[model samples]
Target chain A: MARHVDVGDLVDRARQRQPRAVARLISLVEDASPQLRDVAAALAPHTGRAQVVGLTGSPGVGKSTTTSALVSAYRARGLRVGVLAVDPSSPFSGGALLGDRIRMQDHATDPDVFIRSMATRGHLGGMAWATPQALRVLDAAGFDVVLIETVGVGQSEVDVVALADTTLVLLAPGMGDGIQAAKAGILEIADVFVVNKADRDGAETTVRELKYMISLGRREVRGASWRQPICKTVAARAEGVEEVVAAVAEHRRWTESHGEFAERRRHRARTEVEAIALESLRARLSARHGEALDGLAGKVMAGDLDPYAAADSLIADIKAEG
Target chain B: MARHVDVGDLVDRARQRQPRAVARLISLVEDASPQLRDVAAALAPHTGRAQVVGLTGSPGVGKSTTTSALVSAYRARGLRVGVLAVDPSSPFSGGALLGDRIRMQDHATDPDVFIRSMATRGHLGGMAWATPQALRVLDAAGFDVVLIETVGVGQSEVDVVALADTTLVLLAPGMGDGIQAAKAGILEIADVFVVNKADRDGAETTVRELKYMISLGRREVRGASWRQPICKTVAARAEGVEEVVAAVAEHRRWTESHGEFAERRRHRARTEVEAIALESLRARLSARHGEALDGLAGKVMAGDLDPYAAADSLIADIKAEG
Candidate 1:
């Protein structure tokens, strides 16, 4: 783990589409290596070229199948693709991550497709915190497109919308997903919606419900020109997948023309920068005021002070020291 | 929101078991109010008398039903109970919160029982970040027990363990939850297991399978005094819920005797205080260096600086400004 890392050399190889180099760079991100700045520095010049698409939905909605099919769809156009999966149930967390590289196995041997899992495993931060940096890694690696997939659980799916240029919210019929899509607050986040497993019963009803929901929610995004599209697909059979591809491309065009593209990139950059700085500040506080924090936590534990007041005292002590 | 808040008076009323006062205090926590520190200061003296319990698992494992039953069991013994739910599918997260107060309706009129949902709906942080404050509110308000229920998704369930004294992981048969429990990194987090809906087919299989998984995972916790128990429950009928209550009490006794109880409280305090300080520092950095962050973010957006280097530059600027 302490070996000297030649970040520049790795970036060069990754840009050349050398698969191992791409995987190694992502490992550095996943591992939170000391050379992360060097790697990010080296990769920055080559980024902002790839399209980042986020795919998210409830479990059992065929998210993995849709991701695999989308990979194939992109590859059909001779485009190189990269996938970064961080979902708990996705091919990512532990033994399941390795064993169930699952449907993504279809493109395992393709030199043009790179699939890597960013396991938090209690690393520096969470899926939301690590994603932008990973996206930048793939973006700079010369992948024509990168698809980021996360399970639609709680705040995670909402975070995906921040890291992606175009976000797809997937649903299947009979999952009561239309109401779920509304409830999860994902209706406003999606750039496109994919109704996978469309061959299943009640597909039409799900699609219609989503369409009506879209119309209802459209007023909120009045100035935003990209109308979220509903693409129906039997992803298991690869039916209607190309239309999703077409829909994503159309979304990219709208974002690019409307200034939303660069704005989204800036927002992503702001989040990544702020998170890194916040983590650095947190480390500094703990290291310099370890005893102060212990005393404060003890005070809170003993009911001598509330957590917020202790927090204020700790910050004041830090400032007073200066 | 702009009205002057009488924090001390409110805390007095809440501790006196005035329902609206209790509800008002939690809303302050939920809203991340400016008066939070004052509220916390007032509540601190009344804290630490309540036991905190965490109820979590995959959706549809009858968590609400089990929770309602547990409230009844505890109320029968003349103990007041408070429930804080943050799960998206649970009686929280929007209309579902007010709409599907669901099985909890049984306890709606029971003044001795209180249920509140902490909605993150784009508030300060995710459920993980906001839960401790909410728990503190419940604890100081004189509830005998606080049950924090979050959807078992990714990192949120793990967060619950850090907040709970006795964490119950629930599962329904035929849901493949046995495997999910292991894969989701929750097997090690459970203090007790509940197989709810025990009348259904495969209930025995689920319980047996969980026991096997727990045994396999137990070696890691080497010297822990508490042996994780599997309690079979048909919560809808309140069957076997007493065993769960008994198990929770027994586990509490072990922790209180073994110093684990105090240690857990210390850890929770440390997390809460640090989060508050970190958030304060984040606000400071953004307030003082908004333009600098914008400049660094633009550099990253333009591929001139990687996010980490930009982060470093921003930090250096902050120190220089000081």
Candidate 2:
């Protein structure tokens, strides 16, 4: 059933807080449908209003619990919230954890809350490409706050940092030490640190270690700013989560006062544009030059051309075709 | 210092088992030096002989230890080995674990063993872009086996699987279960599952659980005859390391006989070529059209143009300029 989607109508319903409309808009973004240009044109003005917070941590950390607690806290304050869980797994398998849904069941009936899971689906640079648009959809749908949660593994943490206004890096007592966190390259990107599962043993040790590590590292001064805070939370029991929320608010305020918020958003928009442009060019190249690419590869494999020269020739061919 | 490098001489020295020559060639690859095309051209005919094996597991799961043990085992067979440890952490920070080096001290002085650590360095798609060339350099330099070790965190595993002919997924007792492995999405990519720390409590349970899970999943038949094997190992003590090697050989034999080996290599080559081409296009776009990109992004941000439309316009501009 191919039909027209009225961008104006969708925007109106989204502004009116219609969950179905919001879901449809997000689906449009996820699918990268032909109407994506219209959807982006429609949603652009309504964005830059929602507070984007990113939550990430290694597997086995209480990211889901913390996210759930924060959602309830925001809902209690009468704010609309949206949660985007980026799953870096096979998209066809729907790898969204059942445990995550059960933990988030508290807000399942709350119309003010929208939770969506995005899978990588094996696309090249897929998560980084799709997330900004998804965030925009939620932001335009009138959510007061949007929380992006991702597994803090390798590049995903970097990707989340680029999209979030304030990023929270969660840790647990026995999940290695501050050095390991530093080794994971998350320490520098973290705006706030949460030692979740504080009710467990060695929470204090984790907190102390993180503080020591943070102290040793040189903090980049974007502007007149605040210090990154480390909070302890038993997210499962909803303890100390309010403190995390407060830290996020505090960071947001600091960024706004220092004029860094606008700067960050501008950088994000530029990055999103570049990613899309690159993807578009790649698609065009592949569609137009599939045979040429294979021929070049065959030559490279047969030692008739080096890969670098082959790449140069391919670029030249693309330009000539253009 | 900017003197010309003789690519043929470097390749000759590398084939003659000179570690300095191998290191220099790898540096050229990592830096994306202008001479990389010449280097690749010189090295192409000598490539594709090494058996590439990928070893990955979660942090603290004895991946480094297992890798060290396997290296020693391979060396005992009078085979030259190359180790490329992909650190997903900061490239500039050189966050490669001192423990990794200290553990592999046994082979540090062995001319036949070349160990190198590669960091992501904050580049876009850096690891995936750099690993293939690095592997090719090693393969062409006459290593009998090249072991690619990466932290089994999220997307890094997927990257490693693409470059390896066989992949070994390591697990330990008390580090969660087969379900956790499935959640991590490593179950499907693994050719061999190693229960490291087999002396620890619950080791038998981990092995059995992994076996049961592997049985339940539908394995893709890429070759004539092969079944994923589960092995138990105390890597620290070098126990069962030989069995892992034997399994790698068995998988290699199966793939070669079934023609999957050539097929996989062709796919790997195709992927590498595509990555290089894409990177080349991105560089060209940035160099030749920086202002155009910024202008498009500005338009998108100001709501005058949607990002998709802006991208289309940007592509059009590039084509026109070409």
Candidate 3:
């Protein structure tokens, strides 16, 4: 077993806005250490402060550049910031490419900025399983803003919306059209849409298409009252990034004024709690009922039992064990 | 409650190769109807016969066209084929756009060719939860080959590999370089690489880059003895598609000769069983522990308890209730 981390010391240091301490707490959560329960208990009181913002787009759509620009803008406001990049490519250690790391090196030396990448290696639940805990660690660490970046690819990647108070869906010229956006389901999760690389040709066309798509009212409006704002940004040059940041802040204001802020956070908390409980039950079931499960699988394979019937029997066995 | 579906009648009709019966069985799996257990029990013996092949790529990578061509090729071989298009855009029903539906009209009238679209609307587990059951339905319904087609954009879309005997990763020229392929992790999941749209510019470059990447030996090499083959196809004109089909058959032969076929199926069965059990436990937990869960969520929200601790408490309560 790994040596026990000192939860109290870590909490105290994190409360003091120490990036190393915050990173350590997140590492514990990522590793799922035995002391995670104690760490969670220690940090609970300090959370629910940071505004969680999610940035997602198709790969090569300048998500990182836009994220970096947003970070700089937030830091310019003299607020502490935390970045959690859920990297699908590297699911083992949450490793970022050297180029990506160098791109964000502007904030690397700042003590008020904490950046961490999380890998989804063993997480079958995808971002739904690991992200909320990491967000809590950053939230408790006194960051005023937390930026969660994930590559928009498939269904589970959209879960970032569940964790963020504001979600920016990024697009670039020549990537695809409004039909592709609608097909990818990004329109549904986006609170603010950012058209990056605005200097490129067809930028205006992309903007027009996005505006038309938003006007369609096909997206499942979360709050039903907030109209999503579309902003164009040349993030590489830091142009229009401030406008994007301002739109995010406007969303925050809207949600708060409408009393959706607390409601959203409460819902997020409930989801996190439920996910944790479900994972725990699954872990216990596998650990204790390994043989029985194997037996059930054998029967299913042999056509003596269906998977549903086998599942019912397995659940019964777990209940009986309890 | 919906009336119980007659498992025996459905199975008999499906086994007789009735498209309506197969469709109904898949609908039950998608709706997660109560009679699904009986259906699975009846279908269990009839599965492990059809070859499950999964074709996935980014949107606009010609997945549907390639799928249609492959269906035609299999039909030419006098083999019945079933196509399941997991449409992300249409969540309520597994409905395809008119254009896509029309593209497959050639096979639509053939009774031996059963094509169904599955919506991922409410499924949080992605393909892991529903695709296997649907595959079982088709497999039991006497299809010689089941083509699983998904718009591969994100992480969870990779789950199709778990249910496929052979997974074909499709790419098109002008999409990107091998680096983008590596970033998407498609290279790892691909048992065979199909450079679709080979008539387009940079097709040779795409094929060469993919060959170089595969030569790097980065993929896990599942069976360890057989090397992945890269094939090029202009799926639109049906050129080179037969070669792709030949590659798929070669792979199947290799796996069978190496005894990897049965091994892969067994592994798939184990994963399917575990997922079902986990889903069942979650449903039961919500049904039985609603109030306790709500209380725990309240505590977590109020900061009186951390989510991890609350999750522990919730699990203990569940055990105690049992």
Score chain A of each prediction against the true chain A by TM-score and list the results.
0.91, 0.93, 0.94
Q: Write the per-residue lDDT of candidate 3 for residues B1-322, one digit (tens) a residue.
A: 5696789999999999888899999998988888888888889888778899999876667888999999999999999999998766443122455556888998888999988877776345646678889999999998999999987756667765657899999988866666556656667678889999888899899889888767664444566667888888888889888998899999999998999887777767777887888877666556777787777877887888899888777777666663
TM-score of each: 0.90, 0.94, 0.94
lDDT of 1 by residue, B1-322 (tens): 4888898889889888899998898888767788877888888887888899998775456677788899999999999999987754322234343333866898889988899876765422356556787788788888999988766654644665567888898888854546655655566678888999899898999888888777666666523557988999999899999999999999899888988888888877887788778767777667788888888889888988888888888777665644
The model with the greater TM-score, 1 or 3, is: 3
Candidate number achieving the greatest DockQ relative to the actual structure = 3
Tens-digit lDDT track of model 3 for A1-322: 5696789999899888787888889988887788888888898888788999999887667888888999999999999999998776542112455556888898899999888877776345646767898998988888999999887757767765567999999988876666566666677778899999899888999999888777775444677778888899999899999899899999999999999888877778777887888777677667788888777777777777788887777777766763
Model 1 reproduces a share of the real contacts of: 0.48
Q: Candidate 2: which stretches are off by over 4 Å?
A: A1-3, A91-93, A219-226, A285-288, B1-3, B91-93, B219-225
The superposed Cα distance between candidate 1 and the true structure at residue B296, in angstroms, equals: 2.5
Interface RMSD of each: 4.2, 2.7, 2.9
> Evaluated on chain B only, what is the TM-score of candidate 2?
0.93
> Where in model 3 is the C-alpha error above 4 Å?
A89-95, B89-95, B216-219, B320-322
Q: What docking grade does candidate 3 earn? A: medium
Q: Across all candidates, what is each one's fraction of true contacts kept?
A: 0.48, 0.35, 0.45
